[model samples]
Target chain A: MADASSTAKYEALHNGIEPPSFKLPLIDNPEIVTANTLKLVEQTPDARKRFLFTTLTRYLHDFIKETKPTTEEWHGTLKFLSRAGQLSTPDRQEMELILDIFGAEALIDTINNPPKDSVTERALLGPFFTEHTHDVSNGDSIASEGKGEYMYVDGRVVDTEGKPIANAVVDAWEADDTGHYDLQYDNGVPDCRGRLRTDAEGKFNFRAIVPIAYPLLSDGPLGELLLAMNRHNMRPSHLHIIVDAPGYEKLVTQFYPSEDKWIDSDSVLGVKKSLVVDLEQVNDVESAKALGFQHPERGFKLFKRDIVMRRKVDA
Target chain B: MADASSTAKYEALHNGIEPPSFKLPLIDNPEIVTANTLKLVEQTPDARKRFLFTTLTRYLHDFIKETKPTTEEWHGTLKFLSRAGQLSTPDRQEMELILDIFGAEALIDTINNPPKDSVTERALLGPFFTEHTHDVSNGDSIASEGKGEYMYVDGRVVDTEGKPIANAVVDAWEADDTGHYDLQYDNGVPDCRGRLRTDAEGKFNFRAIVPIAYPLLSDGPLGELLLAMNRHNMRPSHLHIIVDAPGYEKLVTQFYPSEDKWIDSDSVLGVKKSLVVDLEQVNDVESAKALGFQHPERGFKLFKRDIVMRRKVDA
Candidate 1:
């Protein structure tokens, strides 16, 4: 058992800050409480910190006043938040998933990376993205044979002015036909994910399996919240890609297949009309053969899109 | 080491809920994201829950839009919250402490339990309260000898109209003069805290140590937050008490000594004007002897107040 007095040591140390010079009236009412809190927050020396906390306090207090949650409900909310944190792991980002499901992540992403004409809109950097992807050469397959049906993804990285940007690093990841990422399996190896640098013409192509729609974790607090809200926890099938090049704003985006059933109601609110693309089924065996598919006779689905990035100065 | 595949098991289980029939417009912008989230929240069958979540979504989104915290700041927030939960134990409620320091708890309490005429206002039931406490008779000392300077507390539990409430239970607890609760010590036994019943005349009196002003735990995320906000972490000296009786609302509150230097600026925003009381110094040896102090010559501080409880119907 843990020692009960473990927290006692913290009680002895002070933050070394003295009381505020201004006198606060007794917090006899709710308004006084808010006023006093804001007054104290104003003491922050950093302008950005002060503004962020002041705004947060105002919105939080407004939420409490408008919702008027009972004591039990408030306690339950706190318990749920704590459980979300406790369930989070390096691979399983339960807290971020909560923010995603609640649409907060989407909102923040949208605000920070606002849309620019001719520049690809940013999307949520989901919990599945990993830096340990295998490096593959052009026209190489990101997935091993038999992972799923054949799919060829090709795209060109270019500036908003339509100039190709050569040697741009592209990282792509997606769930397999089983609706699970490579990291979800016990094999402890990166699969159905790869990193490749664009050729001299800013062109890149990778052979992969067809991505499948999947559900977020349904056993944790996020699942419970979705259930309570009477919403499905399924995300539309999409391929996540991040492109980076010097002297340009990094582009983080996703390509969603328009035909997916959950395309409109992505649980994370990550979908955009501009990002959705149609996959063409090409039955030509020669086309699959040229793409290095093991079963050329089965043909392959072709996905082609050109990514537009903005310069860092423009951003 | 924990198995990496432990979370994979949860991935296979879906929430068993179908997508809503309504078509959410493509979430191409921040406005659409917030609109879709509120729409989804409206699907909740429970009226109260729907209202609460809808309000919460609005304020949360508004906060995000107003503050526009950078991606790094947002991630930092999630990490801080997760650390708070990880550090919390059965005895240490780091999550609630976060809410307290942020002033959310005070606002919730104020809104949910609005004050009524002739009734004592409630205060925060701080994290130090425990279920296990010693049962002491009236007029007996709650603290052991040498705990602190002698103090005699006398109070009556009465109705709003001043009628006596016989057999009412009064639970009293406080930190010692050294600014620590019994639970804060490693002894693992209750001290400086007790539960007692009122007499037929609705009178209750107890002997205890003089409560001392103290700083809150300053080694956790809460401390970091206070330091960042440029605020102190001190709570004024106060005795915690809970009075319960038949056909009346249970009162959870604290009595702050008016003379304490920190009385006006409670770190948790718990102090109220009506809850403040003055401790009368009694120097007469006979008075101290009658109150059962070990050294009558040293005398004792006297705290006397009558608690007015609102009836259940009135509340």
Candidate 2:
């Protein structure tokens, strides 16, 4: 009855009824079977699935060929997108974070950026990459909150030929006294994160804040995927680094603190054997002062290291 | 400065802050990495995909454990989910459609739904399951509107045992003169959709409609994925059916109207050789009336079919 009335009304309005505006556009295409799906051609794997994927893939292309978004749906998509920007902070690059968690970040970088020839593996741009580093001296403390371990770290940046790459920027940052990134400190002291440029001889050093293993944020769709995997989210002690040179491919990598247990199990597959370094203690005051420490007698740990990179042209 | 003020306020008003309130419970029995993931493990033809599947499954678990959502985020997720339901229609099961395009629906139905012993392959629940079909004589006409070839289709539904399955329902619906489903016929006249029950002797008949080939909806995320995969979305001429019996598993299948130009290339991979039936014309009236048609010379076609099903225990 409703159909009949609606038909009559439509006829009265327009000389003839027309298709509802929502119908999909017409398309014609062929199906291609791939090695990945050939075995499921019959029996156990279920042939319908193979056919469905093959057919649906074509349908999807046609849809894209004729993309149509309603004004309201388009606006809703835009509005939802705006919230992603609002959610970002120094400790929270929610947009990039979302991409990372969903695997798109890894996929795009892997496909388009393939670790430039011989540069150190490029890690993800995590939420904590701020512009400046606190200028702590050779033995100055970074654990101002007075919590966590009290160890030291040191390293150098170099090129493929093992020569020290002078003046390379070796910015570093990490969670602080309470295992929370500076921006997440929410309490205002962005003291836990910092950066440092390597010296003329390609050496860089810092003191205070022995790093401890900590878990990733335990919330959101990403968190849910991780928990379902039964894997631990703890990251081993590590120092973030961004090495850049005018004519060399830049490298963003991390040095895992040797004692932290999760180095071998970094969830994002960020840890590498060459990126692990040891922090040894030195009780010599004169030696500390030579390294620019005000407290010569103050105990300090030392990290000595070098990094290699491929020439930019080759990369 | 703001940090200092907030610190002072915190000390004066609430003493030192306690630990953060958002701690996630860690697992006591963490899963041991029993096997190296980089090596060949599953020997199946799709070993690579299988490995990826397992790896992602585990990773998702871990992600969930670490990212426990705050109450607000949880509520936001709920609200986001409600939109999926609001988007559904009789012609389109949005959620099921998503599941189909994502392979989740087939995976769930194929691997999870049926008992281990069934021989019939489980297929996906398509978007066009809404239209109600009706009973029409073999020589009857179904051309209410739109355009296509004038075809007279005849076929039988049989079980593995080859016995007739009496009174099985053969509900059918398809596109009219235009390549659109009844749901897409929002303008008027619920034309090309109907339901028809078979006679006690496993015989059923219908007339009038000869459907044109059509394209599936190609807009949305599913469409985008298809574009990335490079495929099209066209279904060949076919009759939809839902064959049911008291003790047998319900069969929702389609029979191709023999000779679709692209029968071999249905994007959805739904063309089965066994399901194709030829359409014949009957110019004689006595033979048409013997089969119970009111007219003969007026140019009607005769179609005879039997439906068969497997016995309860065997089925």
Candidate 3:
């Protein structure tokens, strides 16, 4: 039987009286703690979510056990995590960068969206992709102004069987000559990023400045972590692309210029040998004119890649 | 030769013309991501800190690989963690609660402070402990006024030899009759909790209200988590104690009243079979008068325990 006090407490609860809430008592025993904590994850109906929490809960307990952090160290970690969360915004995904530094993004991508046979290797879509990018027609210059080595890119979206997929959405973005994305600058909109619909032949084209390799954030906690790690934060120059079409898998990838030295040690590990393109330069007047170039002598670097998407399977 | 733009970017970085900072790029490959991330924990002169970060980084990546959460799920987890951190205050230690729910606290305690052959088993001191509790004399009422069932506790603290150790400090605290600590109530100082000095015979006494079993917080993320787990948040009724003396290890522990059904299911996992004790009710008027009781025949419950401390090996 419940004690008289317990009965009174229940009555108070039923009568709309909520007492102040406090933290649970310390179990002080690790074995029971893990067992009891694992028992706390049951009623969630969503299988995927439940699985995620269970795994995460296990990992967290194990990490703590292995580390055995002192109270000071524990507080330090909590502070760092707190700063990471507080620093995040809709546009600024600092937490994602934290995951990158932890190498979580790459692992998750490999696990959830692995490449299939004869399919192009996928890369991280990254935090910079803005939803509803400005729509454009083929051959439109996504660049806001003349800068660096002129880059000309034309690609096609096709099924794995090589059949042209018209009406496909081809989205592309890259950094400017200064090794910065449009969002990183005061210019606001990503001048070198846009979307285009594939033509009747499944072809899409975008003209912009070739991107320059650059380092990651150098003034934040992530940067501090990199400094602590003694690792260079540089990434190779590349163009990011995403192609979505009816009945096909949404492809997210990036293509690095082969000549960039950082390509081999791309900080974010975003490169696959198949995704690296060897750009061709043509100073010949005829070749430049065919590409609608205003100056043949100042030949632009041509980057070409045909995206082959796989059929989407129902989850 | 480096491209002119590449040269310019390098020059800008070297010349302190640092551009704006943003999140790092996604590495895309788990192997390289892990390698690159492992290379990030440097500049820390503290060896323990270096070890901590290196292990944490590995575990984080491994956990992600083992559980490839979808973007939405990952974000949801991040948000939950963020909220936990944001909700923490000097008084409200939500992060600690999160740790408790995850079972980290128990594991850490076990790993860092192992049980010696003859020393008392340790329990977490918990955040509710107030430094410099009001000192009480033997047979004094630690309770300020009538609350719940009257409780009388007397204990002795000694080394493994079982010899009386004079001048030992015995600190004690317990929940009120309603399962609320003085800190949880608006009545101010924990009139139910205090510390006392052992007399020449290593004996101490404190009179207070019997502690009531209570539940963990059921209002925040941890509470929601408990709900999801479908587990009752109740903790068994117990009294927390700490005994310290010169040349002996401090002993921190709790004693659960055997009558409480939740003893085996203490939410904090703090209850051990050895820590359970039965309280005796003395209903005789003469016995009540002998113990300075205000009521005859309606005697209070009496609790008794002897604390065994080990010789301190080091400072």
Candidate 4:
């Protein structure tokens, strides 16, 4: 009865017995598909999500129309996506790396959290971030046995006005001298990784070896894709850091060594000019004595950097 | 020494003592990233793949810029994609369905293979396609055990000129009365699925239960998405068919019951005007007996549709 009534309504409208309602007619094939897709997205009560799906559908359709990938290419893309999902783990984020490779991650971050003002530039959190970093007192060594060349890192947490922010939690991690991260090795405890809190004066310090530049993990489909695309897989030596303090926004970033060979060729494309720190090399004996190192005769480089934080929950 | 020499060359250029070499200036950040990405793809000797990746990066970046999805929204999309990939199995093509949902698959197919020249309209193979179908003799029933209302189908494979194409292989599949596809249940073997070859006159016949209108597998994220979007998940009653001949292009398509309530609202957007068949009910006992049905008085619907094929390898 309902179908008949609707049919009659359409017939009446066609025969000029009734006015045609102002409704979109389902005609064009692609348009019909878009209408159907949007029909589902329209039900989203969350305004943000609704907008996101709308844009996703539009751009996805646009991409397909523009690319016109063959059936085989389409199927192969699906297969590659499946492999990427399967390659991910709790510790390894293959899909995240894919986003970095595509430059979406950095672009999205820039969109959501624009970098300006006096705050430290936010870089990629990357796939290897593990909060398992054990906190130590200031000037403590995060370097596990047999890591990179000894390096001293002294930094301060501050507001836009450069006011020292005391008690900020500074977590840090980096790959070893061989360019392999701690998780890449058999040892459960992370090597060349540690955390420390800001002192009353807002200054914090930790000792670790210099990070080594290395290539990304290319054994998976992403790696194979990069290789096929003729892109380098290397990242410059850097230290990942996350700073958290009450009443301030969380800061996730990394600082690169200015002298690293791959500094200009970082594979993940997460580099920023301000984030690169110039290491100051000091005499071995003088440096060890000043920093109270057990091996006073063995000198290490020093890096000093200051970080600024936004207010908590700042958009 | 190499670094020193390069620095000296730059210094000489800066001092106006040497001509600057023709080099790609890395100005734009995103462009630099793209250039680096292209650098790797350039290593591939395969020209087609190189072209594909080049377009992929362009469109991907364009999408990000146009949509400006928030960090959370981007992450959510990645999660949804990962789930879609993980949800797939040998019998189910979840990603393919996702493509259909986004209308990319249909749009791409249309763009690549335009509909014209009397060729059969293409339809999605859908996740339920099974090559496990048994080859049956002509006029044999494909309905297994107890199922939906019985129907007789006779079809002919012909060229655009209407001449019969003998020995053409006809494959057919559909869901049962309960709206459950063969792959959806525990049945090791499928019902309502079979293939036959054209006779001397290019005619083929089969008996099967009428497929009922059914919703797609909405237990997955796709279902949740549709429900959220306030769209019906149902697809109209249809029969999936594939016709193949030695010198003809393989045709994968479906015929929709014109009377089906959801015929015009197929969730997959796969229905076409030429593919809708009007099933004719025949209570004629004499005709049933002629068709070799044991119970002639128990009437059955009859459908006769002809399929036209294009030459194999035609562009």
The prediction achieving the highest DockQ against the true structure is 1
Model 4: per-residue lDDT, tens digit, A1-315?
223222211110111111112232332355555665566455557786677667778877777776778989888888888777776765556777776776667556655655578788888777667877777889889986456688889989998888999999999999777666666554466568888899987999988888877766677876777666556677778999999999998999999988886676555667776788999987769767777666767788888899998877655
* Alpha carbon lDDT at B315, candidate 1: 36
Report lDDT (CA) for all predictions: 0.86, 0.48, 0.70, 0.72
- Best-fitting candidate, measured by TM-score? 1
lDDT of 3 by residue, A1-315 (tens): 334332332211111222213233334456756765665543345677577668877888878877788866776766676666566666556656766656566666666765566687777776678864678788777776565688889788888888889999888888777776765654345577898899888998877778888776655566666555545677778899988998888888888898886665554455666788889875676776676665656888888888888998878
Query: Which of candidates 3 and 4 is the stronger one according to TM-score?
Result: 4
- Candidate 2: where are CA atoms >4 Å away? A1-122, A130-144, A160-163, A185-189, A216-230, A281-301, B1-35, B38-123, B131-166, B185-191, B219-231, B281-305
Model 3 segments beyond 4 Å from truth? A1-75, A131-135, A186-190, A218-221, A246-249, A264-268, A281-298, A311-315, B1-72, B131-133, B244-253, B272-274, B293-297, B310-315
Native-vs-model 1 lDDT?
Answer: 0.86
Please count the clashing residue pairs in each candidate, in the order shown. 0, 50, 11, 7
Candidate 1 runs further than 4 Å off: A1-12, A131-134, A246-250, A311-315, B1-12, B130-134, B311-315
lDDT of 1 by residue, A1-315 (tens): 226553454455667788899888987688998998889888888999999888888888888888887889988988888888888877677878887777888888777777778998877677789998899999999998877878899889999999999999999999888788877777678889999999999999999988998988778898899888888889899999999999998888889988788998888888887899899998999888988999999989889999998888743
lDDT of 3 at A272: 66
Model 4 lDDT, residue A304, Cα:
88
Please give the ranking of all candidate structures by lDDT, highest first, separated by commas.
Answer: 1, 4, 3, 2
